[model samples]
Target: MATAYVDYFPLYIQTGIEAGLLDPELATFDLARLAAAIKPERDLDFAFLGLQTLYDRYLLHIDKTRFELPQAFFLRVAMGISLKEENREERALEFYELLSSFRFMSSTPTLFNSGTTRPQLSSCFLTTVDDDLSGIFAGIRNNALLAKYSGGLGNDWTPVRGIGAKIRGTNGESQGVVPFLKIANDTAVAVNQGGKRKGAVCAYLETWHMDIEEFLDLRKNTGDERRRTHDMNTANWVPDLFLQRVEAGGDWTLFSPDEVPDLHDLYGAAFATAYESYERAADRGEIRVFRRVKAVDLWRRMLTVLFETGHPWITFKDACNLRSPQQHDGVVHSSNLCTEITLNTTVDETAVCNLGSVNLVAHLTGTGLTAAGLDGELLRDTVKTAVRMLDNVIDVNFYTTPESERANQRHRPVGLGLMGFADALFALRIPYSSDAAVAFADSSMEQISYHAIEASSDLAAERGRYQTYDGSLWSQGILPIDSLELLRQARNGDLTVDTGKELDWDVLRVKVLRDGMRNSNVLAIAPTATISNICGVSQSIEPIYRNLFVKSNMSGEFTVANPYLVADLKARGLWDAVMVSDLKYHDGILSQIDRVPADLRELYATAFEMDPMWLIKAASRRQKWLDQAQSLNLYMSAPSGKALDELYRSAWRYGLKTTYYLRSQSATHVEKSTLQGTDGRLNAVPVAAAPVAATPTPAPVASPITTSAVPATPPAPAPEVPMDDSLLDAPAVCLIDDPDCEACQ
Candidate 1:
């Protein structure tokens, strides 16, 4: 550490230069002065996982050795983002301060390739396929190119027509969207970037599409091998009319795009009208390849597939398109891999979004219920900087396809999301199910929404507004919160949609109308399961998974104890090694422990402990402020058909644009957590069936990440590599920053 920073100051640059890891322009900076700006002490704030994540994947490496320390890595990223600024050094310093302080971090792509030769900085891409062989193949090729760069992708499969549809070229019936989706799913698996992680592409099919039934079955375990797409994620793009039909228990009909192509171009009233017209055509035998079923039956099948296989996520088509600020430009045919992005995709343009998340815990002024709270000024400052960094990504990002580049430049969309909501709530000592939690969610997101718009508008003042700013909802002075009225009007009093706003929307609305906005869309909430682990916080807008249970991911299993829970317990003289043992035995749920206080138990409720309604209520609140969407996972202990049905209906009624995964809990026994038995060996504790929410399998590790800012201990030794290429092969490395769910934060 001394040799890299203090002794030579600019040694990292020299080392990087020799290894050919440093960008040529990056080499021209007065790196010695920049090296001097590194705050080595700030490294101590990071828990071991945060530091380990940097060392293993983020730090620039030569061969197998990592020379970049935490502070220097932060500075390098800052320098990369600010390299084009007129006052590069000053701006870099500002970026460094924010990053080194643990206040904010860019998405994975930015961290990986920001200062490298190929800076493909955007996190994910969304594309739409036209109903043609050339266009479909082109969409698949674009998916490969983008996935070859970064993993997350969203493809709209609705326009590709359906089974028994006429084919002009072959004079045979079309095979429908499933066969094409299979190719896309296989492409994602085949084109993973340098084998870093399996590329993930979410194929979205509308509920109205005739192929929707098979699309829902793509993830089923018992499905025909040729039909199942186990590798790729799937989502149902349901419009409001379908939900209304389901609500009224009316008959629902599905049609192929080949026959009812106009339905693909409509939404809300226009969509309902076009859909009925298509149904009438089908009745008259004008439209072929159509199927009719009870709306509730189809809705039930959608839920059954979702709960059974956890794919084909439920996303509201009308809600997404209706709420989209860029609805003027095109329709939002699909959401991105994580179900957070809602950008428009057309035949000529593939929607793109650059993503970054604010570490919510870092923005809080202090820790614990009494000390920690959000300072309005500080949050605004952090969001302003984060928005700027995300916007900068647009210019710096390397696009893989012309369509992606075209869409990105025109709409200039960015997903400014957040992590550590659970952590922030823990600090405030709020129960996940409490009304207070909902209020906090509502207020915090409102603040983020306000400042993000303000920052975007401010950027537009300096730079010009996005190319498609005209005729957008923003041009009409309609903010996301105000757009609910549009939905109410579009639905014609069939639904009562409320903004549930605690903040003054009118004031923010006026500011937005006056200043114009730079970006088309903002404020999406990602799972942040990976990035949160790097920052040592809970996943985005999610309740704590466990207090002392092992979190197993690619890096291996980590025995994470909730620090805030510990602090609260310790304050009441309840926390100790015994308490830890008990928590481990009970699988980190406090309610099972008799000695724990009732209030603390409520505050420490895990995902399955609270009602799914609370999740919906809070998300609905957050959704009101967000212009995009959130990757919301709803948990159910012993999920039932009736329970699942009501939950989704409530979600639609609350106006949530998307729900990522329906994580059902299983009745399983808790295992002993590294506790010694009579033989002084770890024993599995045989206990009553404890409910466990389903999550991606956790891979526990034996080693712990060191947290000292200073080198109180030497850097951990690196694993050895074989000299012969064929002698030894390393296991495929998966990104550990997030849970299996896109590992985002």
Candidate 2:
């Protein structure tokens, strides 16, 4: 493997440059030295799914044959990102080590275009659509161009007037935001992200809009075909006032932006005041094209629509704006496609964010939690370098639109997050639903937050602060933790999130104030759908979906087994054909297996098997450290309206800025025909047994196991049934088909 890479690297570089795929400057590198640094053995680290994904879409290929192997691919990306550095070769090597060793990984776009001629390294972009026709078309056109270069998008549509609003120039009623959204959806479909991936865009509408009900129905299959935006993602830009009204069971009024234009920019108390005043105007018959409805009724409808069709994700407007570090600069109208990026978007300035993640599994010091389990020094060094690489992307990136270029240059935001949280937990022997897990979430994020802030401050000391740094929260010496006070004040002391700190944040605060900050925003947690696969780790901040399942993707199907569970079983002499059959019989759920140890069952409990409130609690801990937001997905095996109400309310009370997909247990079961030697046979499962409901509280850990046993002989082969291809097509734990899922990495 080593010899193959060493000999072919120079030739690959030559072919790439000749084909105009690679940067011309790459030809000047010491090809021999770079090739010699390639550690082909790291290729062994890849699971089948990871390697297949790389080969299918990531690796640089010529004539449909991959010329760049895994290590070479990492080196190529590192070299592309480090091309402008003073010691470009050294920096490239350092970055290569991080990538190949699975210590850090950049977003999909950065990996795709990093070493290429057009390095469109930014992952996500946000643009606010103006109410006017020209401005709306401009925003749509910008979407096409941005998506053409493989960037995910979020468009704030609150400024556009709702249906029944008067159009003064034409002296007619407007058809509403839905029709324009239809055109935007078509544009995204047409672009298709340069044919590499689906062109994805999310449309956000404020809850107070008169067309709010119609916006909520965009993804429903029952709606009029012409009125629905089936191709585009939708999110409700919910204000705290709406929730307050819902809780109060009071009436809520809607308005057209033309009549209430400033509502798009207002948030928190100002929004509440203006909204209430508008309600009174509607009651007094002073406002036109306004409607009134019970807030509770509307809230129930929102949840019902959400359960029926997974659209119009619930995202809080006030939590996003109130806790924003750039609150002094502008208001955050909405989050990006993944709901992880909360930034100010305007007609003149489109928001752009560069993203990357550190592999948490690489920073651990032992297999189980110790007093000093996480290597603080190693994480600090990794974050420092990762931040530098992300910062370099802004200078070297190929911007498709001038608006994106403008916003990126002025604020220079970078999201340095993490992956492999579940894997790290497994290594630490901590159950996902336990208090120890929540505590680790807090400490780990606190450490990442501390280092990311300090890293930006270090960059500011050397390279000067961002152009708009003076008016930001850093200028006021308020970090993400300290900014919670702003949210508390905005919510009138109703907020209920923990603000405990383990690190000496004041020292970092003093450093930030003294040196200013290189980036306006430093942290966000994107759903690392594909990159986590490349690293062979669990998805970003997600619980284990299953112990064993076949994952399907663009690369094809591959079996994913929990290696940690397998190792523990093998140690206890429980690994056998019977165990595989048992897993298949229960659809990879270990809790039902009588032969498996109770402690192991708790440790390996799948996502749906555990109470989802634990996910919320863990996210709340992480949210306090994240400056932007997190792409948090809640999983429920059995869902109810009441449970959803309590869960989302907990999210808001915990000060969560945004939420992502709400995954429910699929009715389909994995086929058991693929087991070795068993043919079509499956281990006997109790016919009357039913799945346990995931209660909203943590359950105590099971007692440790002393002994376990498996049957001496496997069950005989049984009659085969016709195969269902749908089972093969079902999404794996990590790779949901949502277009925005992996776009932000």
Candidate 3:
């Protein structure tokens, strides 16, 4: 790391200059001052995972000799974003201070290629493909271009004709979206991001599409090789009418968009009426190539596919559009790769979101956290600066396609999210599943929403409202909380929400209504999987995966223990060799340990130990205020069809925009990470900073994970096992499948 100053820095600059990657002015910076500003001590802040994430993909490499250190990487991104400021040098220092100190972090692309030859600083790009063959191929080309850089792709396939539909140009029947999706999947694999990570894209199809059934099978292990798209992500763009049909036990009719074009553009009651009309028309033989099925049966199949193959994610189409501030610009066709992004995409315009996350761990008070709760003013300041950094990305970004650039400049949307929520909650000593945790979730997210809006309003004052802000929901002062009524209407009063406003919304609405807002949409809670690892905390809005486990990533497997749990244990003199053995033998949960306090056990329950509704309930509160969606994942120790039905129904009843994956305990995939082997068992190693023990963390049993299909594929009939209290004592880690699109996090 020290060589960044004496050796690696000048060589990198020389290489950058030779490749025309660095700004000409960068070569003239005072090296002496830069070296002085660099604090190598901050490097110690990185846990093994954070340092490895930086080393493998982020650190600048010359002939595979790692050079750019962590602090320097922050400064480089700061410099790149500040290039056009009047006092750019000083502004760079300011940005560097915010970043190096871990108060803020830009998205992966911004950190990776920021000051490089081809700087692509945006995280997500949403585009709609035209229904024609030329347009479809063009969309494929666009995906390649964007994925070649760093943008995760979301393509809306709703407009395309379904299987057996007549094609006017070719005088043949359409093969439907599945064949094209395979190509897109291959495109994602073929266009890896400089071999650092896989290029990720998600194809979205509306539930009414005739190809929807086949689309769900894209990720199955035993599918026709031509149909399986294991490399790409798939999501269902479901409308509220379908859920109502499932509830009412009505038949759902699938139609080709070619036969029923208007349904794709409609939502709410308009959609229901148009869809019923299409069903009647198909019954009268006015429409061709239609299939009818029991809505509940189809719903079961969707859940089956999701549970079996880990996708097609269930994302509500109407709720996303109904709640969208940018609904007037165009309908929200689909969410982005990780499912947190909700933006409009059309053939003429591509939606783009430049993302940054505030590290919530830094939001503690000056009076020490216990004395005073969360510091609201500091959170506002952090969010304001983060918004500025994200806005700067719109100008600094290298748009791969003209459509993306056009839409980005017009709407100027930015996603300002948060990470380390679990860490913050742990610091506050709130149990993961408690009512207090739910209340805290509501308050903290309300604070983020409160300040993020004010900060965006501040930007509007300085930079003027976004080009399309005049007729947006913000222009009418329709905040996200107010838009819940629209969703209630869409779901026909089935949705339940706590009708409470904690903040002074009346005053803020007036301010926003009078001044307008800068961004079209804000506040997306991404998976934050990789970045949370980089920050050495729990992933976005997630509980601890395990109190101790081995984390596998681009870096080699490293022993990871929840440092908060360790500190609490060490404080009570409960951390010892036997405690380590017990933790390893029982897979890092404290329920089986008799010596620990009951409250401590309750507070430190692993992801699988607590009921999942707690996670959803908490997310529902955040979703109430978030303009964009969240990458919410549902976990179950024992899953059954009935259980899935109730769980998803509750998710809709609570009005969540999207859910990522349905993780099951017995079916955990071990491809990415495992903690079972004797060589890899995590002992008392801290999650972040703690005094090292005289002896290293002990690796328990040496048994490796079973590499077989049994673990990967659960039985067809979802297990109906009751929640067993005894299973909490079992020696199994709560392994989560990392998103294929870890680059965005």
- The window of 10 residues in a row where model 1 has the poorest summed lDDT is 694-703
Clashes of each: 14, 1, 2
lDDT of 3 by residue, 547-652 (tens): 7766677766666667777767776777765666677767777889899888678667878876777777888888999999988878887766666776777777
lDDT, candidate 3, residue 351? 90
User: For this target, which candidate reaches the highest lDDT against the unseen true structure?
Assistant: 2
Per-model CA lDDT versus the true structure: 0.75, 0.83, 0.77
Candidate 2 weakest ten by summed lDDT: 690-699
Task: Count clashing residue pairs in model 1.
Answer: 14
Cα lDDT tens digits, model 1, 232-308, are 88889999888777777699998888887888878988988888988898899987688999887788777766766
Instruction: Give lDDT tens digits, candidate 2, residues 47-79.
Output: 667878999888877778777778888999999
- Model 3 misplaced regions, further than 4 Å: 1-15, 19-21, 28-35, 366-372, 666-735
**Which runs in model 1 stand beyond 4 Å of their true positions?**
1-9, 366-369, 494-507, 666-673, 677-740, 743-745
Tell me the alpha-carbon RMSD of every candidate. Answer: 10.7, 8.2, 7.0
Position 516, candidate 2: lDDT: 94
Candidate 2: list runs displaced more than 4 Å.
Answer: 367-372, 667-669, 676-739
Models 1 onward score TM values of: 0.90, 0.92, 0.90
